[model samples]
Target: MNNKNKRLVIPLLGAPGVKLTDTTLKENLSDPFVQFKTLYKIVERFNPDGIFPFMDLTVEAEALGLKIEFPENDNPSVREHPVKNRDALNEIKRKWKGVSERMITFIKVCEMMAKEFNILKGGYVIGPFTLAGELVGVNDLGINVIEDPDFVEEVVDFTTSVIFEYAKALLETGIDMIAVLEPTAVILSPQQFREFSMKHFKHLSSELKKPVIYHICGNTKHLIEDMGKSGAWGLSLDSAVDLKWASEIVPSDVRLIGNLDPVKVFLQGNPEMIYEKTKELLEKMRDVDNFILSSGCDIPLGTPLENIDAFMQAAKSFK
Candidate 1:
């Protein structure tokens, strides 16, 4: 999407940074020093066309006062859903100051990455529906969507405001792109996705005026049409999607950035196998110019470094 390279190679890389730097996920996430070191090591080793910080979805939710549990090795998870009603959400809004320290830590890391790296630097923000799910719990949100549509709209609107502010902070650091993590919206029907997620995504992408990469995990083939209309410059899809098939449906200008199975191709397979799989994907997409080869999602922790090398080599060597 950046157009700096004919075939850009940027995996949704994060947890692997911890594994590469010999630091725990908690340490790298909390301290910008640890965060920068991990990312810098990744760039040095992999030489990716673009680089992004750890894709921790909990940053925005935790900042909004949700209970979060952080494990040493694994990514953090939201533990408490305190907003049971409209009044509860209003209370949190009334007391809101700004983003928390961890959010600032990520922004600071972006600043550091901006100063040090010449390649494209990216930032992450949790999508509106996903953050709302964290606040009210996914089950209640789903039920309210059908039974109480107005309430669901109000909650989503509030979450969008919160995300907009956070996105502005990330953009201030001079990052090239922001990927909105909207994994929760994967379960919604196409119409529901357009109504709830697409509307707010358009707002963020338009207001920021930066290349927004819409990233949703799992099989997103059902929602491709709405996602293409969300004003995103690119779509970062998961392994379940067929990139060759999606390339036909997605808009001509929008770049496609994934499909390689992170676990199967990068983690479980050896280098030779990884090379063949990466090459296979490359061959399928050779006719499409707006394509960036990447892992379907974030490369899992404990993935072998050599396998990553094979993926990069395959992309670079392809005609």
Candidate 2:
């Protein structure tokens, strides 16, 4: 509720250049020192007052044995489906390397930044169900969920344990909070959300001991209340969502972040359009002390710098 504690402030993020994308393999992203140092430079310049890096998740799905393919210019996208069936999916156990290349790089990134910046530094972990989906293919995971709820639960729980150790590694770096990117949670029904996503997150929430933010990047208006109960300190909605409405609907104690249409406004639109949307978002959030302005998701790779600058001007225009 205190915007002054920029640590508590939720500002904007990007997919790659704008937000940290999980674009590396275990080999590349693990050493986040240089990358994080670069990120800190951006944070220092942007001066969002607080900092939340690009949501990067390397260990969660990797430990489960999914092969990741890193692209040259863009963020890493998931490449392989490791789990052949329910049996193969449930074979995973917790194999944690909090300080692996991608993992430790990000960890050290957080540690060094936390020490130097007084920034509310933190990174992301892919949630269990999504991780499971990445490993087992979304369609396959869904099929398993219907045919083998208990089997799916086991994998989900196993995936969550990996996220737990992965998160602790980030915290060990002395980061402020954890952003649990639950991107795939959007595909589940309310019932499925409870069965798979909710329990898995609640388990992590119980163990993490720091402020946790839950983000599902889609029309999750139906799941907002359910999401609020997950014990996260904040809730970040995508650009397709309405931030003011989320503020009204979500409990006051839980901070609300985002809803900026990153692509339509920031990437493709002109500065005036960006400025107008910026002003409109600021006005919408004027009365609310707990909201942070941000793009619906990460800034696309090609977004103009000036469009993002307009949002910064809007943030500084607090009076």
Candidate 3:
């Protein structure tokens, strides 16, 4: 973490590397060599202060035996949610082995990045509630949260255990930080988020030795206080959040990592638009030393390279 007045720029910009290289999204995820090459090209192009490999929420679910669809052009997605009841949950847990081969593929990528890049390197894991949503269908997970809160806890507990095994492998690769992606938690009320999502993260943060960045998609203003209390080193929020407001709510010691609109400002806007947007965000958080300049979420594939360039230049030029 940059403790000085200078803010760090760590955009979540991995998928676009496929456009720069001769690889597809599916290939980059499965083949370590291809994945490394794609990300290497991204680093060579932007040269950010820190980098994380592609953000894949399906890795753990697919590793746990759930079917997944890996698109050639886009991110992989869970194809089926099999855990409908306690018996199904028990069945999956009973058959559960350790992390799968593709899981190792990502860990290998981390190792390559750690040995290759001198700057801060990070890894990601699907957060407990999100993984639970994958196993038990998101619709069912939502209903269960209210109707069968106990069952939801049981499922989340299992998912948390699964994440522990995968996260340990990532940590062993010498990465500097881990971002727990909990996009599904956005639908829950603040109290529900604390009970179902935040507690498990507390346990997770206590166990992992590295800094944990609690990343949740969409507007998380309602849940920011609980998110701040999850023992994570930082909060990577989405474009909908007001980062300046978040900085005031979260503790001064915790780093604040984003709020830039990845789509409207980076993917859709031109270079000048991006520069101004990035400059505006930088200006708002100027007095906050713990702020890190970044996109609200992973910069979507096909975003113009010049847009990214503008973002970096704006951050670098800021005092």
Candidate 4:
């Protein structure tokens, strides 16, 4: 048994971090290469099978001419909402050059890592509605969806195409998977999810033949069926969702991951508590197969390493 070609064994993790799109880390995202390098190190330390690093939130909106302001400590935030009018869409180039220095640099890191380690190479990207949120602002996009249906549809479709193309490019890079993060979709009613979010998301999933993971940070119990229907291979849930009920809702064919309280338990709980919580959840999953253990959301950066070790210890024990 040679070591180089070996497939490493590791458990899934709810990738943890600060809300970069909020107020920290944004200052450094201006240089995508530096951003990728920084994020990769943190991910490599965790040693998960794959990771969606911090570079996800900015590229699409920034490319679309949104005024992105970076702060010293956080991920980049959108300074100017780009979709004030339909004309602004032109600012985003339709063709993917695979040569955008910023975009290509991220891929180069993945290629480099794939050469060195068997770990999966991956990253995140804003979903259509989320990207649209950066464009029209969250409240404004909601208003437009009801007030101007045709315009919202047009914008969503355009953004959806870019999401698909950009993600398609990443999947072709020999990486294991890409998480299509449609965080805004969590706010929609389940019906709205079926109508607006699921449609394009389904299309996006279909176009990317590689595995896709969807993370909607909310009580996603009501939307699990739609998630299954959307063609995503897996769904990441917030801690608010019920684990037992979710296992029943998700189709057996599609793997369901998560609902650990990332902040309450992982951030504040002790290792024994972490072990207890993980043991309880894993027991709940006893009746189901195809479930990957994970946190409901990104594990807080300050999460106790002991708790993390305890959680992984439980996973490694799984037969």
Candidate 5:
């Protein structure tokens, strides 16, 4: 699609009111029918150009035998790092079953969304580096990347294999696009990002039949150019990024999809405030033809529907 003329507003709205609440995530995610109904409700309420099925980053880790704790109000989070040593990592790789793992339920949801929803259907996978962090613990992974570069590479390589298989399955389900969430890569320098994350991302992007949107939270000012080199069709940025600066540096072909503060603007603001903020952002990015107005990241739980409505209205009214 020509994003230049379309003005797409594809905010990440996987919070309680729009999608499934925490109470429903465990019960609903496992059941395709319930997941479809939940996703349909989100599509109906938001009327977005696309539907982003459950943004839980823990799905990949959980599939690798890591334990996850589902909180009452928040997204599920990984509770353990099963691959603590080389032996453990090798064991995981040996036993890894892509389609039959815990993530199968999520793949089924994507299939349901693709077949049932008329709008663009999108699926998400935690980026390989990020999934590696879940498996080995972020702190340990960081230290190991410097103290034991070989070990880090091996772990990330295994994760790349896991993500590739999982992404391939999602694509087979007919989703229009896939989003790779690489929040862990935000801590790496540009060169480190290229070596550890971008390479694997390029592999995924090249292999996937559908377009890939790469997202990294926090300030990506240093990595914008490198991020464009990852072969993704679009780059989803966080609120810490300056869209104008990013637009200037990143290649024009890579569509830019964010920077709106999900918490301050969507969760706390009133409709009028939300509309004004939306208009402000629209004006800031007006010159960037490939820009798609979106929340910097997933809209948090309890964000007001009226605020979201105002955001859409402002985008629609922008001349």
Candidate 6:
């Protein structure tokens, strides 16, 4: 795998039926061995440049005592918002037990992946602003950011502390990259993102021992320049972003990792369509040296394995 020749294929392929089933998601997330087996199957199947550890966004919130609802067929989601004010936020911080308690299994999974996989093994953490939204309802957080900027800052600061502690633990596990998932930040204006999210992103990027991949779902054309200022080594965009435009705006050093429509081509379409779309995207991004071919977001549950195979084959077949 020479660096120049390597066309990194790092799609989000850890959904049910891509390598495992809903049963695996239900049982294996808490068991390190099961998690490893499931992840190994995915890596063995896709042979991606990097493989993600289970990317359940609710794990941190769950660790913080927020209730989560794990539906049989979908990703688990936070069901409750526990932090209502500064006092409640402080109280949760006081009782914080660090990543050792709830995230230990996830940490162990990362360790196992690092020990076994020779390629890139990445770990995921929910971004501070998004995690803050999980703690206090997103609507409330949005209102507070406008009405009481100080209160919003306090909550985001608390969430950043929690994420930093967890991130340090993940890095200690020897994972090659850390991806900060910040889907919640897409709703904010570019200025608001710089004020609320960029600072924390810079802080985490500075503290990380490895490169940080900043991921934000939905339209982010408005924030591309500000995202570059976050100090992240990579920027992962969702399906709505125009990759060509993003590649032109960001510095050459910042790697651009995605824009494929996971649902349209990978899930609903057949292998031929997958190959065509993958090739189209590769050609669209052909001149961008820092581009890495990948799904815009996590491959949805029930996406056919053959479609993923087509995705990889298409990337490989391209010059």
Winning candidate number (lDDT): 3
> Per-residue CA lDDT of candidate 3, range 226-259, in tens?
8888898999999999988988899988889987
- Where does the lowest 10-residue lDDT sum fall in candidate 5? 15-24
Could you arrange the candidates by TM-score from highest to lowest?
A: 3, 1, 6, 5, 2, 4
Off by over 4 Å in 6: 17-22
The backbone clash count of each candidate, in order, is 0, 14, 0, 13, 0, 0
What TM-score fits each model?
A: 0.97, 0.89, 0.98, 0.83, 0.95, 0.96
Pitting candidate 4 against candidate 5, the one with the higher lDDT is 5
Q: Is candidate 1 or candidate 5 better by lDDT?
A: 1
Q: Residue 298 of model 4: what lDDT? A: 67
Candidate 3 stretches greater than 4 Å from native? none
Query: After superposition on all CA atoms, what RMSD does each candidate show versus the true structure?
Result: 1.2, 3.3, 0.9, 4.8, 1.8, 1.5
C-alpha lDDT of candidate 4 relative to the true structure: 0.67
CA-RMSD of model 2: 3.3
Name the candidate that leads on TM-score: 3
Residue range 1-319, candidate 4, lDDT tens digits: 1132222222333223233222234423444445445545545555555555454577777656557676665445788775666676554444333334345555665565555556555556678888878877888888887888677777788888777777877777677777777888877878877767788888888878777878788777778778877888778778888867877777876767786888898889998888888888878877666666777876765566667778776665655
Assess the local accuracy of residue 203 in candidate 4 as a C-alpha lDDT between 0 and 100. Answer: 85
The residue-by-residue lDDT of candidate 2 on 1-319, one tens digit each, is: 3556442334555333333333332223544654665566567556665676555544556555567666554666678877765556545443444435456556776777788876566678888898888877888888888887787787787778778888888887777888888888898888899889988788888889988888898899778878878888888789777778878778888888786887888789887787788788877787877786767776766777677777777666645
lDDT of each: 0.89, 0.72, 0.91, 0.67, 0.84, 0.85
TM-score of 3: 0.98
Mind giving the per-residue lDDT tens digits that candidate 1 earns over 1-319?
A: 4574478889867777676778998898899999899999999988899999988989988888778899988879999888878899898888677866588999999999989999988899999999989998999989888988788899899999989998999989988889999999998999899888999999999999999999999999999977877899999999899988888899978989897999988889999999999999999988888888899998888788898988888988987
The runs of at least 3 residues in candidate 5 whose Cα sits more than 4 Å from the true structure, single-residue gaps closed, are: 18-23
The predicted structure with the larger TM-score, 3 or 5, is 3
Candidate 2 lowest-lDDT run of ten: 18-27
Ranking under lDDT, best-scoring first?
3, 1, 6, 5, 2, 4
Tens-place lDDT digits, model 6, residues 142-212 = 99889988988998888898899898898899988899999999989988999899999999999876799
